[model samples]
Target: MKKEEKLEIKLNVQKESWKSLWLMARRYGMSPEKMLEQFVADLTCGAGSGGSDERDLAERWYYRSFEMMGEDTFVSYLCSDEDMIEEVMELKGRITKSEQYISEVKKRIETGERIFVHYGKADKKSLIAATWEELGYESREAWDKECEEEIREEKEIVSENEERLKEIWENFQRARASQSATYEEEMKKLDEFLEEYGKSFR
Candidate 1:
């Protein structure tokens, strides 16, 4: 056998499980460490569709698992490690502002201070009876203007978040590429070490 390069990973398991794994490893004529390495290799080894890389395959599995658990899988997959902190703070700020604005609007509605316009030729009594549209021209105009401004502000908020999300996804893609390149380099070095060891034994 060649002197293969070794990689170590730490896992937390119950004492009984560890004992069982050691027994199983001995039965297979290998150490527990080698057994665990083989297990991990078998679990992760597969050719993804359309020749996708390991990172993409791992991401797909992660997304599927989170979705099965009824979690916000899109948010989980969208933000890179670096983006999460900054983006979450920004989102929280936006949410706070939105909540305050909504509270103010609710207060105005409760106080009957918001404008409601009725343009039909109704008598004063009829106009007063109208539920939603019975305000004077000036009040109606003010309400319409306020609504338009609110809509524009809402759109701007959405657009900004959307752009930030796009940037986060781009950063994640680059990080994945970098990780994949590193993995390939490590594998190549391991293979070379194994080949040299085999030649030395011969």
Candidate 2:
């Protein structure tokens, strides 16, 4: 029989995990590298070299079935990672909530309400109701004027709130600094809180 060529491969893992693995190897009376090699060999002992190719082909067809059926494709995408069932449920829940919100927004628009949309720090905008006639406006010019006025009023309200927020932020900074000996730690906590809050919108 021909001798199999052995190759060395470096595996990067967390420091604590690597230490624990070495401890386990010591307990088993084997070098860490040998233990890992044997562990992997045991895992694939029954699989021939063609096994991976066959597995890949099977997976391809399994996914292709979902693609062929348009209706099931979306469901498959949502359930793609079976290990992350909770994440999938959360995504489905968000979709349901969004559908409900869109229905409400549609009704509001039908009733001649402009749906305001905030885009980052840009000028305020809105989805103007369908048409002048549908929105009960006498003319397109009148509808346009009303939209401009409403948008302008909303911008002014936003500007006022921004100024109020600036003042409140300054006061908050002073208060937080005065209350905490670890002012930097307090600020770091605030940063963490803002990051989590922003993630909710995403």
Candidate 3:
């Protein structure tokens, strides 16, 4: 085997591209050189090829990060699965309805509209109502009590969604950790291969 020589290449990149690369390198806790080298190695060996499962996982992680960063204007990668897409659409519809309901309630409160509630035991029910009358009416308290259960349920729904988001974030973190571990193992293998190859020329 002939000895292989290492060559240094100087490449020009846009400032924004450089910044993005730097940020990604920092995100992975890697030096820019190692980060770029690994990316090239992965690309060359088709480890990050678009059709590969690993690439699909990486793409999902990419979109998930964007979603976490509030750039979720587009459909999520998870939505590619028919079942997941249906579930997400349902949740989104429910969330939209909840928001509209809350907004209407707030508008009604602001406009001093009357809110009515059924009070007393089931056998002795009476209709009670209240509004924000100018003479220091106690309608606000009544209104709050009237909607207390509903408000609590809404809060619980919001909390559940938040917990789900947190779970997704944790899953992404685990996936990222696994990818990093695999990358390190691949780098080690490449180093070993290069070392053996170098010795073959001696």
> Which structure among the candidates has the greatest TM-score?
3
Write one digit per residue (lDDT tens) for candidate 3, span 69-158.
Answer: 642211223433546434444454466577676666665556533333132232321223322453234666765655555666776776
Q: Candidate 2: deviation at residue 185, Å?
A: 18
lDDT winner among the candidates?
A: 1
lDDT of residue 146 for candidate 1 = 67
After the best TM-score superposition of candidate 3, give how far the Cα of residue 130 lies from its true spot, in angstroms.
9.1
Question: Candidate 2, residues 58-158: lDDT per residue as tens digits?
Answer: 55665577566543222222234444334433433454455555555455445544423322343333234344564467775675566556555555555
Candidate 3 Cα outliers beyond 4 Å, as residue runs: 1-76, 114-140, 176-202
Winner on lDDT (2 vs 3): 3
The per-model lDDT (C-alpha) reads: 0.54, 0.51, 0.52
What is the alpha-carbon lDDT for the whole of candidate 2? Answer: 0.51
Ranking by lDDT: 1, 3, 2
Q: Candidate 3: RMSD over Cα atoms?
A: 20.2
The number of clashing residue pairs in each candidate reads 1, 0, 0
Query: Candidate 1, 19: how far from true, in Å?
Result: 8.6
